[model samples]
Structures are given as C-alpha cells and as structure tokens.
Target: MKRGWWLALVTTLSSLVVSNGAAADQSITALAPFEVFADGFRDLRGIAIDASGNVFVADREAGTVTRIAPNRTRAVVASGLQHPVGLAFDFAGRLLIAEEKANRVVRVEANGGRTPIILNVTRPRWHAVHENGTVFVSTQRLTRDTDRDGDDDRDSDDESDGAEIILALTPSGQLRLFADGFKGLQGLALNHTGRCDLQDPDSERRERRHARCGRTDEPVQEARGARTRQAGGSLPHG
Candidate 1:
C-alpha cells in the first residue's frame, strides 16, 4: 500500500505578530497553536511563497499545486501534474515546479498557464533558484531492474545503485551538470554569497560549494564535452 502525507499550517500568536518600541521589551506569552488551513492536501511535497505572500504547495499524490492566500483562502493553481515535488519562484516570479514522474520542470505563468522549461530530468526531487535566474535541480539516477521481471524493484534489500545528481539550468535554457554522486539528496538552497548547499540525508552529509552561472571556482562536472574538474577536497560528513 502507498503511504500518504499531510500538510497543515500551524502558527502561534507570538510568531504571527511582533511588537516595536516599548512593547518589544515585554515578554509576550505565546498563544495556543492554531491551524491556518486544516485539510485538503494529499502528500504535500514542496512549498513556495510568492512576492504577494501567496503560499504555493505541491501535492504529489493529488498531482496538483495549490495556493493559499494570506487571508486563508485556497485556490488550485495547477492540476493533473505528474508527481510534482519541489517548488520555487524564478527570477521573473514565475512558479517553477519539478514534475518528477513527468521528468520535466514546468513554469507557471502569470496568466495561469503552464510551460515546460527543463525537460528530460531523471527523477527530479528538489530544486533551488539562484538570484541570477539559474535553476539548480537535484535528480536521482534511474532505478534499475536487475531481475528480468521487467518491473523496477525498490525494496530496501534490493541493492540498487542509484545516485543523486544536481543540474543547473541557465537563464538562456542551457542545461549544465553541476554535481554528481549523491545519495538521497533532499534539500537544496543558495546562500547570500551564491554558494550552493545540498543535503544528503541517506549519507548524513551536507555539501556546499560556490556555484555561479557560466563559471565555477571549484571543480564541477559540466554537461556535454566541457572540461570536468575533480572536487577540491572531501566535505566532512555531518
């Protein structure tokens, strides 16, 4: 049987509002937890907030993306998606969704339209958008069916050798292979200094490197026939 996940927005009064001036010094007792939105999501995977403060979430099981307004109103942004996992806002403020099962990343336009930006991604799980419009996507290697049964087996004891990788999509639509050889890569983010960090929960390691568009100070595996450089050193496992 397939497992399911749920998403809920819970907040405390102290986190909701802050005081200024004289009231700031006073200790405010946190109010009881309250749910902003309680239901209507199936297996929520990724979430992104736009400039207007609308919260967008991807429902993997439901194959839909929903937007929740600040006033707690809900709206379906896109539907019938194939295993949409990660969500981010691009430089132009368009919603970027990593459609895992579809092997593509789609952009949500302001006019409520969907456009495919990055295609042929293998098991795209999470992505982060850089300030300069570069999109970094983490993907898993395809599952192998060692047996001749013609079905992909993902049993814990199956001994599959799938590795996770990170790819960068330039603003001009060029795809570049950023990094490789990760296991169970989950979260990806970019710091203020333009350094890219990714988490591999399976390996219990956090990897970070400065990754810039069209350039790299450290070693990186580039796409196509571009020169490949080995990583400078080993990162300490967390």
Candidate 2:
C-alpha cells in the first residue's frame, strides 16, 4: 500500500474584480476560505481563474481538472492525470498544469487537448505566472515508498538531501533556478513587479534540520534566501 501526504494548509490570494467589458484584471486582496463549488470536489488544491471568470481547479485525489462556471455548474474537463497540483496560464491563452507525481508541466489548450511543456521537473508543488510570458515552478521534495513494517511512511525524510528550488522556464523551454534553499517549497506566485512571493507551511522542518546540525548561526526566522526578491532574476520575456 502506498501512503500519500497532502498539505492541509491552504494558501490563496483574494482579488478585487474590475470589469473591462470582455475581460477584467483581478486584484488580489488576501487569503479567503475555499467555498464549496457545488459540493463535488475532493481535496481541491490549485485554482486558476481565466479572463472570463471561469474557475479551473486541479483535484489531486480525483486526478481530474474541473471547470466551475459562474452558474455554479461543475464539470470535469480532463481526467487520468498523475496528481496535478498547480495550475496557471501562459501568454497564448493556454492552461498550464503542474503534474506533481510525473514531475512535468503540461499545457491544456482550449480545444480539449493536452501538450507537455516541461518534463523532469523536481517535485513541482505549485506554479505562478508573470506578465512577461515567463513561467515559474516550485519544487518540493516528496517521495512515496514502503517502509519496513509494510506501512507507507509518506512523510519520511530518510532519502531527501537536496534543498527545494524554484525554477523559471523561458518561452524557448530553457529552465533556470530563481530561488533555492527552501526546505519544502509549496505555493509560488509572481507579483506585478516580477518578484516571486511564496509561502511554505513546513518551514519549521528546515529550522529543525538546522538545529540538528548545530547550525546556531542560522537565523531563527525564515531562511535568508526567501527574503530577497530579485527583479530580472528570471529569464527575459519573449
């Protein structure tokens, strides 16, 4: 039996809607509770709203992508996914999905088709978009394996050794690391100024790791790498 671990903490950005006739630019306010969308979602993780206010959600346990219209009608748009965790958009009006288990990012077009954008990503937990047509993806270190007692230890850290990282992918498919040293990188976002703002629920684990190694020199707060937001740290926009 394979045990799975899911982060219970929900992170979100509230947005103020401004109408522009056919489309609108939503301004994020704060994190709000997830309101039930017709009561059919099981463990909904990542959400993305399109220009028309159509809500798209990636259901991890259901392995499906759902579309919730303004009328509160729920429909499964795609299925058979490998635990897709993050969802975003590209410059070409394509839906980008971060498939966590497959370590790949894929694109779903408007015609109900899918294409691979980037593959072999390192434990991508979530992703966000930038105005410059660049896509940033976050990687968390999660693995599933059977333990000695025949029980799956989903949170076991016996095999993890690398630090978490956020990678930026250019339009040409070139990948670059934007940030590093995150113990358990989860949700990632890029603000209007191209600054990457992210949150980690398991930051306490990193502190414990530092303390175990007798690293008293480390700051008791969040890691230094997380505090700095670099402009143009990502690839140039196409």
Candidate 3:
C-alpha cells in the first residue's frame, strides 16, 4: 500500500481549506507544496500529536517512538518496541501503541517505561480510544496454509480461512469481542456520534464501515460506505 509515501504525505501537509456550506455542498482544498515537518525516519508506521503540539512517530524498523518538539528538537520517547504500527492517546492522556510483532498494546509512560495494557493479541494493527476510556483494537487472523503444504504459511490470501475482529477493552481491564466479519481490517476511529469506524481495505462491498456499539459493548449494527484511505493515527476523544 506504499505506507511510507502515505505517511510522508500526511506529515508534510500544512493546511486544508474546506468550504463553509452544507454537507453536500462543501469541498476541500489543499495548499500544495507542502513543507517537510521532520525527517530521518526509517519507516513511519504511526503518528500522533500530543496536547503540547509535539509530534510522536513510530518507526517500526527502528523500534522507536521519536518525539519532535515544536522547537524542532527530537528525542526518542520509547524504544525497543516490536513493530509498533498504531498510536493513540487514552482518556487519561497516556500514550498507547499497538505493537504488532509483540502481539500486545502498551502504554508509554512519562519516564519512557512500557506497561502492557492489552496482551495476547494477534496482529494488532490499529486502535481507537473512546472518551469513556474504552479502547477498540483491530486484529487480523490469516490463513495457515494454501498450497496444501504441511507447514503453516502466513502469506496465504485465502480469505475463507481468515478472520478479522475488533476487541474492546474497558477501563476496568475487561476484554470483550466488539465486532467481527471484516477483510483486511487496518485502522479504527471514533466518530462524533460515538460510533467506531473501521477501515477494511479488502472488504468485498466497501472500504469503510461504521459499527455502532451498544451499552453492553456489543456491536449493534454496521453501515458500509464508499472507499476511503486508511491511516495509522487516531484522534483522541474528548
């Protein structure tokens, strides 16, 4: 998916102008010739901006989460991570990361300490945090074999044997299966109405789907829409 190019484009765009009108009449205009915000990143998988305007980026290859301050100073806030691909902030302002290779999600402390929050996950790709301290993480389970070989193969594209689901983690540390039945679940975000939107690039019908969760943390219904680009960052709910 050319993730590197997508990350670069996201980090460089300075501004976006949207026409003030009705929902169907509004249009977006981008100011071209973007300026590079920061460089020297090996592979940027995720990005997040803190309340202080400091930009934090996860370099999966380097196993580091570097922070670029407003003054252009750079510092590694967290290191030695295992394939960190998604970044978000919890309701308490704690930095959350999805470590794909580690098969867990962790909270990055102020002193650069790592505390595992959600463990025993499989291919934790991306996640979103709700205002009430509910975390929604997307996971993918691929097929084991495709060529009739006895060995397990991870690169198999047999969707019939694969599955994708989203898990919800409450503030009390209780885990529950929130939603399922997806193809290529990549990213997640909470909309204004408190519904969680999932980006499934390989879905047969659509690219994005919004799943509304009930008070019991179960998915009530899902609505599909047109194709949309998926990114590795999430907005913190108020």
Candidate 4:
C-alpha cells in the first residue's frame, strides 16, 4: 500500500460585521474555533482569494481543488488533479493551478474545464499570474531514480543540487525558461519595482538569489541552493 501524506485545514469563522468608531472594537465578537470544512481533505498547499473573497485551496495529496465561500460553505471545484500545489487568479479572473508531481500549470474555467497552459515543467511548486496574464513559476530539480525502478528517489536530505529555476508562460501560449541557477527555489511573487527577488534558503554562502528576471519573469522563495556568490553581491546574471 502507498503511504500518503496529509494536510488538512481547519476553517475559522470570524465576525464579519463590525460597527463604526471605538464601539466597534469594544463590541466585536471573537472568532470561532477552527473546524474542518465539510468534514476533511488532505495535504493542503497553495491557496488564493478571489475578488469576491472566495478562498481556493489546492489539496496536494488528494489531487483536488476546493472553493471556500464567504458563508463558509465548501465546494469541490476540481478533482483528480496531479498533485496540485499552487493556486492563483489570472488577469481574466480565471483560476490557475500548479502541480508539482505533474510538472505543469493549468487554467481552470468557471465551468470546471481545464486547459494546459504550461507543460513539461519539472517540479513546478508555486506560481503567480501577472496583470497581463503572464505566469511566473518556481521549479525544483527532478528527482533521480537511482535504483531504476520507475520511482524517484525518496531521500530528501541535501536535495538542493542543481535543481532551482523559474519559468515564464506567456499569454499567447508560449513557455520559456525565465531564470535558473538557484539551489532550492520554492515560492514566487512580484514586487512593485518588478525585480526578480528570489527567496532561496539553500544559498550556499549567500543571502538570496535576486535575479534581474525580465518583465516576463518575477520572484520566488523556497529551498536552498549551493554557494554561488558572496554575501551582498550583485544578483547573478543568470
């Protein structure tokens, strides 16, 4: 039997309507204790909130995507996914998802349809959608099957060897290698100044890997990379 890892989120109900002035602070009610949403799910990972405040969560272990409404009702938007990890809202208000084990990014429509936006990505753990509908994603190194039994190696200690990268997905269905030379790239984000500020904890002898990713690329933080530069050095021109 395959032993499955699980992560379940306990939903908290907060008091929504508060009055004006200091009376609001004094009369505010406390939040309810966290409880399982519609019972339970497994291995939750990336989550995002839509304009209407609906929370979309990716269940990594269960291969499902769920929507949590303002009224705390739960709905399964997508199921039978490929180890989904990241969730975001595109410029057009569509849902975007990243799958680590599946090595792809997909767009989910309101009618529950899915289209592959980016493919052949190796370990795409997290992603973000820009205003122009571009997608920036962080990926890790592909695991090795040392024994050649069709399963990747399970040993995770010191796994930051040549396995960090960022990818760009254009609006017109173009995929490009945006950035590389990271050790343990994980999550991604974009700043107002539009610089690629990487969050690499495995930076052998450096603080972080801040690449000057083009407007197409963004920033992300996760695993560690080997020593590439000295502290406070200029961002690598990768």
The 0-to-1 C-alpha lDDT of every candidate, in the order given, reads 0.64, 0.55, 0.62, 0.56
TM-score of each: 0.71, 0.63, 0.68, 0.63
Which stretches of model 2 miss by more than 4 angstroms?
1-38, 140-161, 204-238
RMSD of each: 12.6, 13.6, 11.7, 13.8
In candidate 3, how many Å is residue 40 off?
A: 2.0
Q: How many clashing residue pairs appear in each of the predictions shown?
A: 0, 2, 0, 7
Q: What is candidate 3's lDDT per residue for 189-216, written digit by digit as tens?
A: 7665576767677764433344443233
Q: Model 1, range 1-238, lDDT digits (tens) per residue?
A: 1001111121121133332432346654446654324244657677766767677878887888888888878888888787888888876787888877766677776666677776655667788887777888886543342112212323322224467778887666667777877887767777666788787777788888677764455465445421211223221111
Model 3: worst 10 consecutive residues (lDDT sum) = 222-231
How many clashing pairs in candidate 3? 0
Tell me how candidate 1 scores on lDDT.
Answer: 0.64
Q: Which one wins on TM-score?
A: 1
Candidate 2: deviation at residue 131, Å? 1.2
Per-residue error (Å), model 4, residue 98: 0.8
- What range of 10 consecutive residues in model 2 has the weakest lDDT sum? 1-10
Q: Pick the candidate with the highest lDDT.
A: 1
List, residue by residue over 19-130, the lDDT tens digit for candidate 2.
2321323433446654334344565677776666577788777778887788967777778777778888776767888766656677775666666666655556678766
Question: Sorted by TM-score, highest first, which candidate order results?
Answer: 1, 3, 2, 4
Reference-based lDDT, residue 182, model 4: 76
